[model samples]
Every structure is written in C-alpha cells, then in structure tokens.
Target: MLPINIIGYRRIQNRVKSLIKGPLIRKVLVLVSGTVLAQGIQILASPLLTRLYNPTEFGYLSVYISILGMVSVVASLRYDTAITLPKDDKLAANLLVLSLIIAAMMSFLMGAGWYAVGDKLVGYLHAEGLKGYLWLMPLSLFGLGLYQTLSFWALRRKDYKALARTRISQSVGQLAIQTGVGFLQYGQIGLLLGDVFSRMGGGGGLAVQLWKKDLQLLKTVTWKKLAQTAYEYRGFPLIASSSAFINSAGLQIVPLMMVLMYGPEVSGWLLLSQRVIGAPMDLVGQSVGQVYIGEGSPYILEKPRSLMELFYSMAKKLFAWGVIPTAVLAVSAPWLFHFVFGGDWREAGTYVQVLAVTYLLKLVIVPLANTLTMLEKLKWQWFWDIGRFILVVSGLELAYQLRFSALQAVVVYSACLSIGYVSLFVLSAAALKRHVSRSENELSKALMPDPE
Candidate 1:
C-alpha cells in the first residue's frame, strides 16, 4: 500500500513538472518560484526575527533603509531603467557606464553630506545607535545602484534565471547573517549589516556574472559614446530622475516620518507590518514587473496598440490577484499577526489593515506603470509621483499634527495614496492610448504614396 501511494505521488509530481516545460511557462515558474522561495524565507524568519530583534532595532533599521531607498533611485539618474530600451548594445553599454558613473557620484555625495551632518541626522531621527551605521549607507547605496544598472543589463540579456537565482541568494545571505548576528547580541547593527551584506550578495553576484559577457562591451564604452547616450537619453536624467525619486519618497518617507512623529516604537510596529505585507506584495508585483518589462518593453515600443493590450492584460491579472487577498489580510491581520509574531506586534496588524487598500492599489498600478516609461511620458510620471508623494506626506503629517492615532494617520495616508494610484492608472492608460494613436498616424502617413 505504501509503495503504491508513493508511486502515485511521484507520478503527479512528474506530470506537474512536465506541464510547465514550455519556454514562457518555465521562465515564469522559475522566477515565481524563486521569488516565492525568497519571500517564504523572510516570512518564515519574521517570527524568529521579531523574537531576536526588538521593535526599536527594526525601527532604526527601517529609517536607515528608507533613507537609502529614497536616494538610491536617483543614484543612476534613472538611466539604469533605460538599459532595455536601446536596440544597440553599444548604446546600452554606454548607458550602463553612465549609470555606474552617476551612481558613484551620488553615493559619494551622500557620504559627504552624512559626514557633515551625521550627528544632526541621528539626533533628528532619534537614532540612538545609528551614528556609525549611517556611514555604511553610501557603500550600500553604491552596491544597490550598481546592481540596478547591471540587472537591467541582465534583463537585456534575458537572463531571468540569473535574476531569479539572485533573489534566493540574497534572502539566504540575509537570513543567515541576521540569525547569526542576533545570537551575538549586536542589536540593530546586525539587522543593518544583514541587509547590506545580503543586498551586496545579490547585486555583486549579478554584476560579476555580467562582467564576463560584457567585458568587451565595457572596453568599447568610450567617452564619446557615453556622452552621446547620456545626451540621447537626457529625458531620463531630466524628467525620469525626479519622478523616480518622488515615487520612492511616496513609499519610503512614511517610515522616516513615523520615526519623527511617533517615535521608534510606533515606527517599528509600522515597519514590521509593512514588511510582512510587502513580502508577498513584492514577491508577486516585482516578479510580474520584471517579466513584464523584460518581455513587453520592446514590443510596446514597436507596436503601441500592443502596449495598450498588455496594459489591460496586466491590469486584469493584477486586479484578480490584489484586491481579494488584501481584503482577507485586512480582515484577519490582527489575529494572524498576533499568532505569528506575538502579542506586542498586534498593533502592526491594525496598521496593515489600514494600509491594505493603498497597498492593493499600488500592487495593481506599479506593475502597469512601466508603460509610461515605454511611451516617454515621464513628464506625466513626474506629475503623478508628485501627486502621490504630496498625498502620502500631507495626509499623514496633517493627521499626526491633529493628534490622530497612528493607525488613523496611516488610514488617512492610505486613502490618499489609493486615490493617487487610481489616478495614475487612468493617466497611464491615456498615455498609452495617445501613443497608439500617434503610431497609427505615422503608419498611415508612411503607407500613403507621395504626391508627384
């Protein structure tokens, strides 16, 4: 009986495996499994992490990370994002080089700024043990920025497997370090080190993997080419950079503000709740976005109507995945959080519930928002980013000043952000529609014979 049951189970496993053997399905499964495995590691570790590092430690770590996140998007002047756009590898190489150069410059500037104001900044964030750690942000940011530049290059290579593997490696490195450091009683420094080192593992590995294939291309990156590509993609630096920065602020500023307004304890709770929720969100949304941009960007540019179709396809899929799961989380967060992370963390569950709608909207919109870059409406992107940032900051700050509960403030911020995200989606659809219209007009003109 046991042998028969084992044989049956093996047959089912083989059948499932054989079913996903097609190219697109295999790629999606690899990336999805990698992302799921990575997030699973974190989600599984959260209970242990919560036990090992107190709320205050996480609070400090969140502040450090928020600052890094906000600044690092601009590290490459958003040129890393343009790596997939150019058909010419030489042009892409030049863009890649440009990203590294700007990343270094920005990282150095951040370090310089920190050197001058490290103490004031620590005092401002109420960071008791973060003065020395702040110095590490520049290095962390540089690694992260380099990773972004190369990851986009990898995307151009269609190295989705490598990308998926890196996600797993990063999580493993982080969890290993964090667990070990917790035992050494290093406090928040351990969490910070774990994050930085783990990120380095992923980004550094990807950079090294690409170096061999791209070594000759790297050599070909002349000053003339770099200058030419940078000038050609000037819109990225001019328009996309601010837009990306502002978009980052919409997500990251809340943690920094929480620290300022509600102290580390409340901020810690918020950060933990966000982490748990974002784990799944990122696992799905980021994986989808990566695949979408990798496969869809070129098609979208060449066929604008296809871009609109892809947008609809992604919107429908994202809607199905986003709304219902979040509603469940909102309803069950309190009991689930308390059970999983202990009693002290129940407050974060409430915060997660309040944040559910905003996060859902973000989940739906962010995956589709890359279409804006495809259409060169980064100006519209900048506009929407400003709107989101303003909404998040103003709503939260006003609620805080009015003495609303932290949860209440988050609710207000979430409502505002949800509205902003929906608005951006509408704008993105409009942009894609216009792009299709423009392409059609150009095609019609080209097809028509010249009058003699």
Candidate 2:
C-alpha cells in the first residue's frame, strides 16, 4: 500500500513538472486565452456602459479613476516590477511583505484623509456627489494596488496558467457585477463595486496561494532582513513608479484644465476619446509588460549582448504593431466615431486622430522602457520621465492659454510625450551597450593566452 501511494505521488509530481517545462508557445496559449476573454468582456461592456450612462457620468468616473490611478501608483511603489525580476524567493517574500505594509499605511491614510476632507476636494473638482463616493474610492484603489503587486509572484514563478485564470475570473466578475448593478439602476456604484470586488478577490486568492506554498517561511524570516532587502531593491522602482504616476496624472490634468478653460462639453468629448483609445492600448501594453518583466531580466543579466539586440528587435516589432493601427485610426477615426456613436462623438474622432499619431512615436520607445526596468536602470527612466512631465505640463498650459484649440493642444502634448519616450530609449540602449562592450573587452583579455 505504501509503494502504491509513492507511485501515485511520483506520477502527480511528474505531471506538474511536465506542465512547467512546457514550451513558451504552450504557456502563452493559456495566457492569451485568458486575456482574450477578458478583453472581450471589456469590449462588450463598453457599449453597454455607453448606453446605460451618459458621457457626463463617464467623465465623472474618469476623473475619479485618474485620482485613483495616482494613489494606486503610490501604493504599488513599483514593487510589482521589482519582485518578479529578482531570483530569490526570500527576497520576493520580503518585498511582498513590505508592499503590503506600505499599502496598508497608504490605504489607511488615503481613506482617512478622504473621509476628513473629501467634500472640499470634490467641490474643487466642480463635480457634485463626488463626496458621497469618496469612501468607495480608496477601497477600490487600494485593492487594485494589492492585486497588481501580488500578480508579480505569479509571473516570477512563470505560472501564467494561474495568472491567466485569475485575470479572466476578475474581468468576468467585474463585468457580471457591474452589469447587474447597472440593470438595477445603481448608477456608478456598480462600476466601483465591480472594481473593488474583483481586486479583493484576485489579490486575496493570490495571497492565499503564496501563504499555502510556504507556510513556514514567515516564521523563519526576520522583519529587519525584510525591511533592509525591500529598501535596497525597491529604491529604483519607487522613483520610477512616482514618475509613472506623474505621467498618468499629466493625461488627467489636461482634461481638468480643459474643463476650466473650455466647458464640460469639450472636456467630455476629449475624455471620451481618451477612454476609447486608452482601453486597447492598456490591455495590450499591460499584457506584454508582464511577459517582458517575467522573462527579460534574467536574460539581460546573464547575456547582456544578446538581450540588447533582442530588445531592439522587440521594440521594432512593437513599433510596427502600433504604427499600422494608428495610421488607420488617424485617417478614419472621425468617420468611425460618427457611425458608431453618431454626431455626438464626431469631435472625439479628431481627438483620436491626434492621439493616434503621438501613439505611433510613443510605441517605438515604450518597449525600451520595460527593458530599462529589467536592466534595473529605473533612475535613468525617472530622470527622463521628470523632464518630460515638466515640459509637457508647462507646454500644455502655455498652449491652452494661447487659445490653442483641442487639436493644437493634442499635437503639442503628443510631441512632448514623444520626446520623453525617445530620450528614455536612447538612455536605456546606451547603458546596455556600454555594459555589453565592457564585459566583452574583459572576457577577451581573460581568454587570450599570455606570451612568456
């Protein structure tokens, strides 16, 4: 009976090992399936959401989400990117624990702060009823931060099957919950509830898995060591993450400024265009981001030269992907918007065209941004981001004050953002090249036989 049990256990272990050792294509199949289904839900939900809620409602949600984005960026602190890249499980655990601790502190602060001062803040935004929703805001953002950070462990383990399953489940859960609530005329509560529930479930599930996998690890690990490790490793990402937060805030800032300068109608149109355009970009970009971070860091550290060329090629491929679609969107966006959404959104198509052109230039350089993180050159990325943020914010204000129309503002913003992306790409590529060349020079000398 003992021998029989041993054989069964060995068979189960071998099956698991086989799945892990499967080809990249097989792994990506699982990943893609989940992503596709999730994107499908998003696609279906968009039209329903558009029908159920007016653009004004969406605009309100957009502003609310933008604020949430900034807060989430702070909560995450780029720990997601950091944890997945390092090889040490203990270090990963430390980072995870630290992320949770910081996230808890941030969540508490944000929740408390919002509760105390939300009316003033909401009034400042010129949006009514926002104060009523303030409690929901911090809960949603904190849950999202937790979900994103916990997702890093799945990538680190190359457990794409699990990752994909959780993502799909979350997306479906969100769609189902939101749709049901919308049917019940719950207003924006539906959207907020969907997000909060999805994140809580996904993050909580991942945390459970991590704990079950290594139950004794926490008992053996010291808090001091965890703190030191997290501090040392997360420094770069912390700064880089702040830059990213600023970049996203830059996008939202334009709409707020537009509302102040123009009117809610123009702001709504612009915000609508941004939502339609940003949805697909985020879906695709985020999916690739996980894959690159999961797989690229070890390759860069071990084979810097090959990884450099590989990264260059990957950038070009991504560029091509963005270029073709952007070109089509640039030419047909206005007409497409009219046909799909009627004349109400015709102006939005123009906004789409403007963003499309900028997105092309951005696509060329953004892939390199991921590589920069993999190479642990987060500071360089931060420098470039800060420079662009300053130029963009300043330029947009000037452009608007000069009475530039929506088109002009879009073009100026795009150009500045493109410059930032290009600058970061140049910096990342140069750093990688220098490292590779120096290593080669040393290796050549070591391998050469000395003459007596």
Candidate 3:
C-alpha cells in the first residue's frame, strides 16, 4: 500500500512537471508577454487618454466598442473558431477563406445599412456627433473579423510570436492615432479612429504572418474544399454564433445600459474600471484559452481521460494567476486610479474594488471555458451564457430601478455574475475530474506492461 501510494503520487507529480515543460506553457509565456506588453501600453496611455478624451467621449466610445463586440461575434459566422479544430490544413484553410468571405459580406451589409439608417441611429443614441462615425463601423468590423480569423489561424499553427507582434502593433497604431488626435480636440471620434485603425493594423500584421508562415497551406485551399469545409463546420456558425453573442452580451450589456441609465460619463467610468481590471485578465485568460482549446481539443478526441490531466494542470495555473494580483488590485484600486488618471477618475477606483471578485472569478473561468469546446458542449455553453446574460441584465436593471447609485449598480452586477462564474468553474471541474479518474484507470493498465 505504501509503495502504491508513492507510485500514484509520483505519477501525478510527473504529469504536473510535464505540463510545465509542454508547448502550452511555453506558448502561453510568449503570448502572455505580448499581451502584457500591449495592455501595459494601454495602461501607460490611459492618463493622457483620460485627460484628452474626457468621460463623455469615453462613454460614447464605449457604446461604439460594445456594439462592435456584440456584432463582431457573428461577423464571421463563428467559423474562425473551427480553424484550429480540424486536423487537415486544407480543411483549416478552407475554414479560413469561408470566414473571410463571410466577414466581407457582413461588412458590406453593415456599411449599406448604416448608410440607409445612419440618422436614426444617431437620434437613438442622442449622440448626434456619432453620426459621422457610423460610416467607419463597417470598415472597423471588417478588420475586426479578419483579425479574429487570422488569430485563430495563428493559434492553430501555434505561431505565438506573430500573434504577440500583432498585439503590440495594434497598441502602437491605436495609441499613436489617439495621441495625435487628442491634440486636435476630435473628442470621441479620436477614440473611435484609434479603435478602427488598431484593428486595421492588427489585421494587416495577421495577414502578413499568415502568408509568410502558412503560404503553402493557403495555396492548398480550393473552392470545392472551401465550400465543403464550410458545410462541415456549419454547426459552429449556427450554434457558436449565438452562444458567442449571448456571452458577449453578458459583458457588453452593462455598458449599453450605463449609457441609457447613467449617461456616457458614467459609462466611461464603468468602462475604465472594467478595462483596468478586465484587460490584464483577458490578456492572460485569452492566451491560455487559445492554447488550451487549440491544443487540448485534440486530446479530448483521442485520450479524453488524459486530457483531464491537462485540464487539472490548467486549473492550477489559472488559480495561481487569479489570487495575488486580484487581491492587490482590490486593495489598491482607489489610490491607483486617483494617482494614475487624476482626481476625476477616483470613482472608477471604487468600481474596480466593487467588481474585483467578479474579475477574479472570471479569470478562473476563462481558461476552463475551452474545455467545453473540446467536449463539443456548445449548447451547454450557450445555456450557461444565456443564464449569465439574464442575470447580468436583470441585476443591472434591478439596481437602476432601486435607485442604487452607479457604483452600487456595478456592485450588484458583479455579485450576480460572480455566481454564474462560480457555476461555470464547478461544472467544468466536476466534468473533468470524472474524466481524469476514468482515464487514470486506463493509464494504470498501460503501466502494467512495464512490470515483470
């Protein structure tokens, strides 16, 4: 029994060490470095941006970006997500072309619709100044969709360096444009331009990287295969599209509601607090998710129980990622906001503190989310996202009706959504644990071959 216990412990220890040396962690380091660099640039630029743009400008920009977030999920019909799933490069390339074509059409449709009803949209937002920005949305959407597709392609190929560089380029292009425009008093248009131009820059980088590294794969793409692949992954476009939107809505809805209930200035406060907390979390979570989904999905198909080893390993990593920084930020949010962005942003600090728990929970949940995709649990993900969206929307609305102050509303939103995040973590862990135990039994049988 003592020897058996020692053997079991050693096996677990070896698996953990393997995870450390594995491609996923190495790739995560590269991507996380780039992401941190990009976010660092944004963080450094925030003081100037907050000074130049004002809360009102930021609020309007939030509205624009939130809308973009919601729309961009469906822009490629969600086919880009499947880019990494297919084992065949030709099939993946076909998925890529299909995504681009869908993106182009979506962009054109949006541009035309905006041209038709631009004035009404302006009236609806009560931001008459945003009217001119309407024309830019389609172009921004196109770039956004294309970058997403290319990012997935990069992840599929494990081209972490290129992905990292594009992130830096986006930060550079966006900051350069906004800073130059800040001197001209272009108001929110400056922010919108930064958003669009950053996407363009990132998209351009991705295109170059895709061509440089995966040119042969691209050359293999044929019309017949492209169409067939499109048909094959139709479930992604059909099922994932809505799930993505609903998931996006859970986050974006708060900003939209802020605009209506509290005004753009308040929306701006919400945006900054969210950004200050969310951007770094997203940087880490996104990098982890890309590797986990792209790499781990294959294991689910071949050695699902073994994949649970990877899942537990990632859970440990995510837990390590969540605790310290979040606790520190929760403690220092107010002083950091006031000192960094000036006195006007003191409230945003409070917002950050109030929502820190939600952000921590979010950090824990994001890396595990790719597990659902690996398990082909799209409908369950959709259901989970639906619950989140409802909880968030209802919580915010309830706060508004109760005459809760803006900060209080955010607190309510955070509390309700954290519950959903916990649920997500628990379900994923339970599912993976069962798989791990089952697979360990098999692993033991395989080990018997080693004994005399």
Top candidate by TM-score: 1
lDDT score for residue 94 of model 3: 90
Q: Estimate each model's TM-score.
A: 0.81, 0.76, 0.80
Q: Model 2, 1-452: lDDT tens per residue? A: 57998999999999988876789868887887887777677766666765565555655666677678767777857776687766778777777777777777788899899888888876776755455888887778678778887788777778787788888888888878888988888777677678778888788777787788766765566789876877687665656666778767765676666555554456666766765676667667767766666766776656777778777777878887888899899899999887776566777788788778666766556655777777677677667766776888887888878999867877887787777767777887888888788878888898999988
Q: Of models 1 and 2, which has the larger lDDT?
A: 1
Q: Can you write out model 3's per-residue Cα lDDT over 279-375, one digit (the tens) per residue?
A: 8777777867877887677776467766777777877777787788778878998898999988888888888888887888788787887777666
Span of ten consecutive residues with least summed lDDT in model 1: 278-287
Q: Model 2, 307: alpha-carbon shift in Å?
A: 7.1
How far residue 31's Cα lies from its native spot in candidate 1, in Å, is: 3.3
Regions more than 4 Å wrong, model 2: 1-25, 76-95, 156-158, 207-275, 282-322, 369-377, 424-452
lDDT of each: 0.84, 0.74, 0.84
| Candidate 1 lDDT for residue 351 | 84
